[model samples]
Target: MHKLNGSFSTGYALLTGLMLIALAPASSAQESKEPDIVPAGETKTPKTRVLELGAKLLQSNSPLKRFDIYLVGFHPMKDSPEDQMEAHHYCHQVNEDFAQCALFDGNTADANLNGIEYIISEKLFASLPEEEKKYWHPHNGEILSGQLIAPGIPNMAEKSLMKGKMNSYGKTWHVWDTGHEGKLGTTLPLGEPMLGWSFSRDGEAIPGLVEKRDKKLKIDTSEVRKQREDLKQYAKPQSGVDDLKGKFSRPTRDIPGVIDQGNARSLPHTTE
Candidate 1:
C-alpha cells in the first residue's frame, strides 16, 4: 500500500475543504436546482483520506482526476446467470476522452482489485473492428441513470465534463470475484477474463447496494438522473459489445498481463 509522508499536505487539506464546500447544499433555492451542484459530508476512512490526498496531488500536476462509478450485470461465463458480480470503479481521467480505471470489489477504497477498465472516445471505438468491439461496453446506462459520477465537482461542471464522455465506450474485464469468496485470494485467479456490462433497465442494479452508495456519498443519483434527461437521446443502444446474448470468449490475441506491442506503436516515442 502507498503511504503519505508526514501529515496531510496543506494543498490536499485545502482541496478537501473546497470539495466539502462544493458538495454542500447552496444557501439559495435557485442554486439548489443547478445541475452542477451536489452535497458531500465528512470523510470516514483512512483509505478515503489517502485517495483524496492522492487525487489532489495528481490533479495539481497533471490533468488526471478521479470519479467513482458502480456497475452490475456481470457474468464470468456466458451461460451462468449465477456468476454475477457487483463492482465499483475508481476512474482517473487522463484527458477529455481517455481514462484508465482501477476496479474495486465494493464501494470502499480498501476493497481488493476486481479488475481494470479503459475508456475511450467514440472515434477511437469506431476505429476498432467488429470482433474487438464485443469486449467493450456502452456508457449510456451508466451515465443517464446517474450510476457514473465524479464525486467532488459541482453539478454544472460535472455535467459539462460528462457531456464529452456521454458517447464514450468502455472496455472492462473482471479478474476478481469478491462475492464467491469472502476476500481476495493471494494470487491472480486463473481463468478467462469476464466481460462487464452496465445496468440496462430501471431497478436492474441491486437496490440495497445503490441505496448504501447514495447514503454514503450523500448525493442523490435520482437528481443526477433528472439532470441528464437531455443526454438520453445520445445514449448508445445495447448492441456491439453491449450485447450479452451469446457465449463469448476472450479475444485470442489479447493475452492477460501482456501489453499489446501493436497498439503501443501508436504511442509517442521518447528517447533519453
Candidate 2:
C-alpha cells in the first residue's frame, strides 16, 4: 500500500508546476471537449469585465486554489439511469483518504457548475453505516474500466493517483441538468437535486455516451483500460456495484475486478 507521503507530494508539486506552464497558452491540451452550453444570459459589458478582473486580482480565493486536480467521467442519475452526463471534476485532495470536487458540465471557462461529489477511501467507506452505503458508488469500476481519468497528467502520475483511489467510493449530487452532447437542458437549474452513480458494468452507459466523450476529448478508453489492467489486482467487491444492474437495455459484460459486495457469482474468474 503506497501512502501519500513526501515523494508523492513532491511529484504533485512538480506536476502542478508542469500543468501551470503547459496551460499558460489558450490552446491547452487539458481544455474540455465542448464549449460553454446554451446561449443564455446577456453578454458581459466592459464594466462587468473590469469588476470581474478586479475581483480576480483582489479577492481571497484560497479555497478555490486548493482545487488542483482535474478529472473527467460520466455519471448517471440514480433514479433515471438513462439520464447520464459527462462530469468534469475540479477536486481538492483534502487528505490521503478524502477529496471533495466541484462538478461541472464542461471544463471551459464558461462551464456550468452542476454538482458536487465527495470521495472517501475504502477504509473510510468501511466505517460508514451499512444503510448509508447505498449513497456511495464504488470507484474501482470507473478506474479499472478507464471511464474516469485525470486529464493532462502523465500516465505514471495518473496511475499513482488512481491507485491511491482504488476501492474508494464517491457520493455525488447533480443539482443542475446542464445541456450535454447536443441535448438542450433546462435553461436554469430546475427541480430537485439528483443522485449520481457510476457505471459498474460495461454497456451500462447509454450508447454513444462514452463514444462521444472519447471522440471529443481525443481519448481512447480501450487503450486506457489496457494500460490500467495491472491496477485490477487492487480492486475489491464494493457496494452499489449491482444497484443499477439490469437497468440498461444493452447487453452488459462484467468488467474484471469490479463486482458487487457479497455477489460471488459476479466476481471475475481472474479475481477468484
Candidate 3:
C-alpha cells in the first residue's frame, strides 16, 4: 500500500509540471502580443514613417493642404495673454515674428483671432501669397533668425553680434555659445527645436563648421507665462503616437510605449 501511494504521488506531480510547461508559452506569448506602438525594445516603422512624412510635407512635393497646426502647453503660444504679449514683445525686440495660435473655441474674441493655437512656420508660412499674409499670422522666425550673442563683427558691429554660432531652429534659431552662457536659452527665440535645421545629435555643425559654443546662450521663452491667472494643459503624452497611428490607420499602442520611445524605440535613458 505504501509503494502504491508513493507511485501515485510522483505521477500526480509529473502531470502538474507538464501542464504548467504546456501553458507557459501561450501565456508569455499573449503578454508579448499586447498592443505596442513599437515592438518592445525594438524599432517601430510607424515612428519613422511619421518623420519621413513630415519631411516630405516640408518639402515642396507633399500634397498636404491646410494642416491644422497645434502648440503645446508650455511654449510661448501656450502662455497667458500677458505672457503671450511679452513673448511677442521679446520676439519683436529681436526681430522675430512668433505669434500665439489657438483653436476656434467659442471664447476667441474677434480681437483675439491672432491668438489661435497653431503656428505656421517655414516655407509653409512663406508659401502664402501676399494677399494671404493678411489672413496668416506672421511667423516670427523671419524676425528672430539672425539674433546674435557674439562680439560685434569687426566690419559690422551692432546688437546682433551673436558671439556664438547658429546651431538649430525651433521656429527660431538656436545659437550655441562659444561656451559662456549661463542657464541655457539665454539669447534668442529658439525655445524648442521643432524643425530639423540640419544640425545633428552628433554635434556635427552643418558640414564644414567645427566650433563649439561655450554654452547655450538663448533664453528660449518657450513655456514662460506672460500672465498670472492662466492654466495650461499638454496634449496627452501619447499624442504623437496617436497622430502617427491615425495618419496610417494602423493599430495604436499604449501611452507608455510613446513616452518610453519618442518616435524612436530602444532609446537609451538616464536614471536619477
Candidate 4:
C-alpha cells in the first residue's frame, strides 16, 4: 500500500479551507457550459427568501460540509461511448481507502447535481466478486493521461492526492445528460442513469472534449501528463482497461503502464 505522507496532510488542510468558502450560500458568479433547465415555478417572494434564510441559519448541514476535495474529469457512457460529458466531482475521503463523491455538470454554484460516484483502492476492489468488478473503471489511465485533476489546490497537493489514488477504481453513474461542449444539455435529467467509464487510451474521447475543458480552466494537459510520468512506477494492471478498446469512433493507442489485469505479467512495474 502507498503510505500517506505529510504532504497529503498539508494538502488536506488547504483543501478544507477552500471547501469552506466554496460551500457558503452564494450567487452563481460562474455559469456552467450546460445550464440546468429552469423548471416551471413562480419567482421567490421576500417572504420565501426570509424563510430560507432562517432555515439556512438553523438547519444542520454537518454531513454536507466534509466534501472538501474538488476534481474535474470526463466520463463516457459505458454502453454508449459517443455520449460523453464533463463531470465535476466534489468528494469526501471517508478513510484511507474509500471515498464518495457528488457529481455535477460544472463547478459553478448553479451546476446541476447529475450523479454520484464511489471510489475504492485496489486492495478493496480485489475482494469484490468478478461480476461486480465490471462496473468499476480503472484510475491509472485517467491519472497518467492527466484527464483527472483537482482544480483549486496547489500543484504539489494535487499531485500527492493523485499519487495516492494511482491504483484506485471508481464506479460512476451519471443520472443526467447535461449535454457536451458546444451543445445545450437536456433541461431535465431524463432517461435511465448512465454508467460512466474512463477513457483508458488516447483518442478515445470525442474530439475537442479535453481541450475545451483545458482552455476554459486555463491548464495544460500535456504539462500535467509530463509531471505524472514518474507515477507510472506505481501503476498496476487493472480491470476494465480494455472494455471499450475498440468502441471509439477514432483509433486509439496505448498509454504506458496501463493494461488489463489479464496482461499483468507482461507489463513492468518500474522503469529501472
Question: On residues 1-272, what C-alpha lDDT tens digit does candidate 2 reach at each position?
Answer: 32332322444565666555565431354645654466468888999999999999999999999998888999988998888899999999887678899998888777888999999877889999989988998888899999998876666667777777788899999988886445678868889999999999999888888888888777789999999998877677788999999998879999997978879555445523
Candidate 1: tens digits of C-alpha lDDT, residues 1-272: 11112121232334345556765542221111111111234546999889989987886743334443323223232234224444555666555457777776554424566688898876677788988877776665666777676564556655655565655678877765445322233334457667766443444443354555566556787898788787654443334322432233322221111222234455565442
Candidates ranked by TM-score, best first? 2, 4, 1, 3
| lDDT (tens digit, per residue) of candidate 3 on 117-180 | 3233333444656564333222122112221111111212211111111111133221211111
* lDDT score, candidate 2: 0.81
Which candidate has the highest TM-score of all? Answer: 2
lDDT of each: 0.52, 0.81, 0.23, 0.81
Identify the superior model by lDDT, candidate 1 or candidate 4: 4
> Any idea what lDDT model 1 has?
0.52
Off by over 4 Å in 2: 1-28, 180-182, 264-272
Q: Please give the TM-score that candidate 4 achieves against the real structure.
A: 0.86
- Candidate 2, poorest ten consecutive residues by summed lDDT: 1-10
The true-structure Cα RMSD of candidate 4 reads: 4.3
TM-score of every model versus the real structure: 0.56, 0.87, 0.16, 0.86
Better of 1 and 4 by TM-score: 4
> How high is the lDDT of residue 65 in model 3?
34
lDDT of 1 at 129: 90
